[model samples]
Target: VSRGQAGKPPGGPVPSCPPSGTKLFTSTVHCTAVLEGFERLRQDGLLCDVSLLPGDGEESFPVHRAMMASSSDYFKAMFTGGMKEQDLTQIKLHGVSGMGLRQIIDFVYTAKLSLSMESLHETLEAASFLQVLPVLDFCTEFLISETTLENCVEVGRIANTYHLAAVDRFVDGFILRNFGALSQTAGFLRLPAERLERALASDSLKRCTELQLFRATCRWLRHSGSRMRQAARLMSRIRFPLMSPQELLHEVQTKTFPRFSPGCHNLAFWRASNYQMLPPMQPVLQSERTRIRSDATHLLALGGVLRQQLLVSKELRLYDERTRLWRCLAPMEAPRYQHGIAVVGNFLFVVGGQSNYDTKGKTAVDTVFRYDPRYNRWAQVAPLNEKRTFFHLSALNGRLYAVGGRNAAGELATVECYDPSSNEWTYVARMAEPHYGHAGTVYGNLMYISGGITHDTFQKELLCYDPESDRWTQRAPMSTVRGLHCMCTVRDRLYVIGGNHFRGASDYADVLSCEFYSPAADNWTSAAPMLRGQSDVGVAVFQ
Candidate 1:
């Protein structure tokens, strides 16, 4: 017999068997040749047992039942589920176009899909109906990767309809992360009611004032061919209570189409009236120096007791070091005195204080609030576990520590720490003893608490609490005896601002003197004094 007929090579050389190490490479070559032969059988329509008649097309694709059934659940069920289609040579697919069917069938045989934006939707729909999970997965992944804020709404709708739960969630998250940008896009203007509801309910939405949200919603409704009938229903999702009344009246009432209902108007009016009834916003007290260095330093003064006006101040103010100008900030919601304020990163946290608005300073409140100067807005956060006032508030390692504040029971030596990440407060090690009005400041890694009033006695004892060690060590006493004063760290040095100092028996005064303690020298030296004497002052350092 000829060599070809004998299944032998037609080459000139007849060599001996190769080394055993080359057996794996020889097996791989044989496997590839077998796959190529199968591909040839498919292309030439050899041993074909089935035909797929794509919708409304004259051409029918001839395929093998085993190949089709192996790649698609629909074909497998037809051939094995005792269906009448099992006996037929041709199966007609309805609702799917000829091109979409071709794409799915090609992927089934080749395990590949070339998708484009133009044909992606139709192909996915066909794959979904045909139960070709691989192609459907490919299409969904492609759409998700290409999804932008401009097309996320539509993509999300499709994903939801196709029951692609994972893709749907991804689209929703993408929409929320880019909500600010998407809100102004055409996709947002045409968003369906269900998707809009999902977005409105998300607390993780980008932080924007209610006024901005209102304006953006109005813009969307006013867009061409928008369904204005849904305006009131959509606008209701907005937290109207969180907005200032002036914002509601002007931006929402005057500008929004289809005027708000009488109930909404009444709600806005009530909130506005309440805001106006509260104490006026306080402006920053400018420094005596007209011009200062080009430093970005700023000082924020929060709530305190104004003895002269008998006012429990909830006002907030910011003094710019570079410009030497003071500007007004949004006031705290609760009129407070003897509150604790500290800066942790960009946020200013206002902690426990006495609510002196009605009783003129009787009850201490446990409410805590956070201020974002970037937006000039304040929002209430998790309250303290213990209601306290005259406490020392300091931010260390991105946490707020409240130490030695008096509750209804009297002065407290208890210590509580706040973590912004969890938005909760936990009690830590107690102080050596209960002391109130004792100033606390964080310098380097340790928290230092110095002079304050405890049991009607002015203290001069200085103590340092190490967070890492969770222990307190006594430090040298301050030369001056003071209480209700403010302490801050500037340039790595400890500073004591104006405080109530006892001049003699039963004689108290607010001292204008300021002093800095150098850790290296272990001594105190006088720094520039304030323009005036002030006590219960809230000090904030912004660098």
Candidate 2:
């Protein structure tokens, strides 16, 4: 590992596979040994060919030409091309700090980097100048994982400067999730008009009403003369039809705003005012601007037991963060529990689970329902090939995946996938062992299932499913064996919340402890435990 690297390398036998000509081989000892030797040689100033200087009045590093050229495109171009520094023994790098350059050189030989928020900017500058893609990619990933409301705009600026395209997903999602708060940030006023408009157009930008969104847009326009030019473009993204008529009349119509070509601004206000005043003509007058922005999150208490009696609930309720209250929404046509819910695009998908029961004892249904929050309605879609309960449903790459869960028959190992485009379910590879009472979520385009029941025992095993290969591979397990837990991804970290763990034959206890998994380090670390022990509980990220 490189100096100051925070994580420990995964411990295991390093496997090496040789082509058809080889008989046998040992742990890829040669690769590590050779790299270590090179590192030692560099440290000892042996076989040094070039001296690379970073910035001005800083220490210079003596390194091999082949090593520098192979690892960095900037060095390759400088030393291999007809540049003036090609034949020179020493090269000076501008705008790259001594520490940053040293870190980059160390990574060239060690394949490890120490990236922290404090040093990330300088390292990104060095990597950008040196054209070290892996380092830039690492920085981008780190930015995506570490970004919060406070520094998200700074991260966005860094990404734009360095061309770290990968952080866009995290940034976009963060802005949508924190639109209400982010709009008040100083950096929000600096956001490009197109980006803000695109975000406003999404149905998932919630937690703020159309009035607040309009007020925020007005403030952005008032920030500078340049922003005033884009008022029409951005204000058009606000759904005036969703705003209250009183707000339209008092807040919008009364404000003396900037003028537009041929008085377009006044017309925009007038049109919005008309949208609210005319109810009968709303259908034909409806546009993207007329559509209400759907809330990105919904924590509903679905069918669950209250006491001794089984309470099968179809009532869909929503919890309001601002008022600290709950409200009812459109309920499901059919009542069920143990089902899996996932959101893909603008629609919410409900997968297989247990339905109403008779004297037969247990019942699991294969029914799949699609909920469109845009209209607050539910429509039955394609059913799963297998009727599974206690399963996990995850949306990956625009497809829904139903993982291991059981029915009245028995626990199942089979897995199936649903493609919304075709409205069909198809079987995928089965799990190594069937599991239930598990929790699963998607992170980095991969599906992770963890903490389930297998063979009548708690399963701490974590399994990762790759859609491209249609296979399930084992990952590091949780510290405590648990089931009936909640798993979710915060930023890029995988979190396992409250669950149940068994001590003995009849000693079952609710797990108050929680832990998170790092797919990069292939390790688990304890997180803040739940306030109270819970099982079969729901978990959703607030922001």
Candidate 3:
């Protein structure tokens, strides 16, 4: 018995609904009342339209609408089993607790959340999958900004793997700044071959020479096609002097025997194997009968020498500008490049430049050929370690400082100081940057490096390297980036003259622009331009 319709016939058993107004009719009426209530609501809704407002606590409605607007495939990939639950758990357990599954869930649900390092790697993967570039960029910037020497190798590896160019550049800068420290632990720095090759091209030889890096260099040399051949040739030239005469004989015998004598029995091996059997010969012989001349005229030519009389020789001629004519005087033993000569006491020391080459095609001589005018002959002094060409060699504090130059490598920052008294070369502080086609002049104790090309890039920055501290510090930027520039000290002021400007591209013909740098203020100001645009020029102060 249940209440129905408007009345339920007191406490009597619920009568069965009837047709018309009977008890059965009342049951049918109750059923009709329920049906009519629902029909009235449907009629009103069909006639009226409902609209949502912002303050109704339904702001999330638009978001939901947007999600529904997206394709089914995208929604499933982002929020479903596509992202592994195990990965999320691992991320939380290992240091990324700050960006755990909650944040990830928020992103999946609302498509937005703040990211941190703990969640950075995960976010990057998610963003890549979701095609969100802003999030990806943020992650890359975070990695680059937080990179350190301790983690540079790991960061660089990741950057390279993902082809993040900007991150790679940042790592390179860090490595360059801490080259010496990193070199000590090069055994741990692991990077790709292309990255290492780019580093090598930029004069990163110090880094490349470390214990582990040297192995990488060897691998690069072995596999590099033409580069390998060139390196082999250069190394062969370097090893020539260390080989003994017996060893040299063996090398020649081995290499030439196949072409010269086919029936040879390992002549190279025999030459190297047996050195005691080699014989020594005496000087050449001349018969007394051949000493006499065939004619009296020829005999007269030797009469002076035969009489043992000292012969007067003609002295060397020199130009007497006051007299406006040439006159006889003591002459230089050889005509040499005025810029290539250095004077110490009574001796004129001549070091090598772009001079004669040995059979191996190495330019500049290691032999420091000395010309003593008093003796009128050239004597060889102790050789330099390597050939230096087109470099600035100056005397500083009684020793010769060979600054920057073009070596087997394009440009070199390798500085070597030569002690005239000891006749020895000792390594000195290297320059802050590798430069060639630049000029160097010593003012007091500081050596200034002006405009120069560093591996094809023009640098307008002026740097000063102090020998006392063995460090280089940036001074002031140059007014213009010019290479092959002439630098001279005029009345205690540094004057830079007629140098070419390279726009890091094509070389501009020499410019007449000139500037002077003041050491006191560490500033450069415009100066009078040179009368002519000169390239490969030299300046000397005469007292």
Q: Which candidate achieves the best lDDT against the true structure?
A: 2
Q: For every candidate structure, what is the RMSD over all alpha carbons to the true structure, in angstroms? A: 15.2, 19.0, 28.8
Return the TM-score for each candidate structure: 0.51, 0.51, 0.37
True-vs-predicted CA distance for residue 249, candidate 3, Å? 46
Residue 291, candidate 2: C-alpha displacement in angstroms: 1.8
Q: How accurate locally is residue 540 in candidate 3, as Cα lDDT from 0 to 100? A: 62
How do the residues 1-543 of candidate 1 rate in per-residue lDDT, one tens digit apiece? 456635557765567886775333346576556556656787998988988887768678888898788888888998999999999998898867788888987776666789988998779778888889988889878988889877888888788888888789898788767877888777787777667766665655555555666677667766754456666566666655455557656665566533534445555445444533331111111111111112244687777667787778888888876678887789889887777877775567888888674322247789988886545888777899988888888889878899987877788889998877567799888888788887888888889998887777888778888888888888777777888788888986899888886788878888777787776677788888879888866665665
What's the lDDT for residue 297 in model 3? 14
Residue 60 shift from truth in candidate 3, angstroms: 99
Off by over 4 Å in 3: 1-341, 356-362, 371-378
Residue pairs clashing in model 1 are none
Model 3, range 428-496, lDDT digits (tens) per residue? Answer: 878867776678777888878787778777677787878788788888887887877778777777878
TM-score of 3: 0.37
Full-model lDDT for every candidate: 0.74, 0.81, 0.52
TM-score of 2: 0.51
| TM-score-superior candidate, 1 or 3 | 1
Q: Rate residue 233 of model 1 by lDDT.
A: 66
Tell me how far the alpha carbon of residue 270 in candidate 2 is from the true structure, in angstroms, after superposition.
2.9
